[model samples]
Target: MGLHQGPDPYDRQLCQGSLQRPGEDIHPPRPRGSGDRLRHPRRERGSVTLAVVRVRGIINVKNDIRDTLTMLGLGRVNHCVLIDETPQYMGMVRKVRDYVTYGPIDAETAALLLKERGRLEGRKPLDESIIKEMGEFKSFDDMGKAIAEGQLNWS
Candidate 1:
């Protein structure tokens, strides 16, 4: 064969520059700036409450995911936080989905989490007296309801 007459070094028949096989239909390139971006269901969330848990370790993780986790207050493994179902929070959760787990949290579960794991300054567990002192909600359950309804801030 001549210098450039043999089988092409990169076979277009075998590898059509994509994963599709020869017989499969290859989609055409999408037009630019068409505003047809893919949308996720979670991105259209409302003001509901969500529980995000960090299930994986930090080793070998990307810096962006780690920063998102830190912004969501999941600095350690098994650490969880209650966040509102807004677009920004949803985006952060989606960005770290591979290293975390998240879902809607009910008022009962929020109350339980507050009673068991919620801490105040100096590492004090949340209690009714503190609630009275704070002059916000009557009890842990009330506070939990406020939090679950996206009426209260975590910080």
Candidate 2:
């Protein structure tokens, strides 16, 4: 009765381009907005506020792990740094803008790492020639203009 009932022709292709490529369709836009709803429905809602802390130095890194357990707050580790959400000394922690870890490195080892990094893709060495050429730019605005217009090659 319903036009020789079989699989609905509209379901297969009509819906495909309706939501995506709505411009190609001659039909007026769907009444209740584009038909597709909940594209990524599984994603969770709500914002999570977190305090990030960075641990530096071999000795301090070790100490922070032990101290973080006794400390209040959410604790997580990212790479070599320990981020403690709950800080014991909240006032002192709030003033911290940046944290850095410095490990001892011999000159030869440093030079080897630099050389290896330079050879890697997307890495460039700051050679004297490059530095001298960069010195020609008086300010960051001039450098940005050159880059935006395709005149400068950062790599």
Candidate 3:
């Protein structure tokens, strides 16, 4: 139907939570006590995250699932994405969990990952000392510590 043709009935129903896609799960977010608790503790206190890594190839996967993986920055295997354990990101991870492995990321691991994978413009590897000299932080360890502690602005 055209946009000027009033709202589509199907669209209305979906927005009102009146329609359910067959075989789709749309329940409220599960309590923070169930599976993956250790790896995805509540982020209400401070910075912590769920580390999602694509573990399998996507051959023969559905288009939507593939898209979800891409959205999470895990379009390829061995790629990892650190997402805060918020409802929104958690929901995305749930969608493509079958093709990925996820767990809580600790501070030490976060620091190490930042050193190994975090890059600057032109694909130049980012070193903590460089950032420290520029005054973004006092030292590489401080930056890494902040990141590991989920104290940096991820946005």
Candidate 4:
């Protein structure tokens, strides 16, 4: 008969402590017969080379994830970057996981990626002649092996 409802059912539940209150820790109790302890496995950090490839586009992507992709040097689709397995790099990769795919890469795969997709100044494709001209390594394979083994320092 009145325009205003006397009390809301949701507010009633909150008054009964069904919702979390400010500055208080509220965790639901586990059901009967449930396991008593929380199980968590520890992971060890190992030295490994990770190759991340951008598989998705930037359409409708959030600014934070876009910045992460930019910092990783992946500005376009199908672009890839080789990074060491570290927490900092892993965190950035995780932030953009939906737009990229990453995994451990072997020496042979690294060489192949360099041969097929590597670029240089003026957008020139990487080739054996350039490697010979630069005299950085014997060939792409050697460079790839060094990169995978963490022997090559970019900086």
Using lDDT as the measure, the top candidate is 1
- Arranged by lDDT with the best first, the candidates are 1, 4, 3, 2
lDDT of 4 by residue, 6-72 (tens): 7766676788876854577867887666232542222234356788999999999999999999999
TM-scores for every predicted model = 0.68, 0.17, 0.65, 0.62
Clash pairs detected, candidate 4? none
Clashing residue pairs in all predictions, respectively, total 0, 2, 1, 0
The per-prediction CA RMSD against the true structure, in angstroms, equals 7.8, 19.2, 14.5, 10.6
Error of 2 at 63 (Å): 18
Q: What lDDT does candidate 3 reach at residue 73?
A: 84
Candidate 1 residue pairs that clash: none
Higher-TM-score candidate among 1 and 2? 1
Pairs with steric clashes in candidate 2: 72-86, 73-86
Alpha carbon lDDT at 85, candidate 4: 70
Which number leads on TM-score? 1
Tens-place lDDT per residue, model 1, 87-142, is 78888999999999988787899889999999998998888898889998888889
How far off is residue 147 in model 1, in Å?
1.0
- The global C-alpha lDDT for each of the candidates, from Candidate 1 onward, is 0.83, 0.37, 0.75, 0.80
Which scores higher on lDDT, 1 or 3? 1
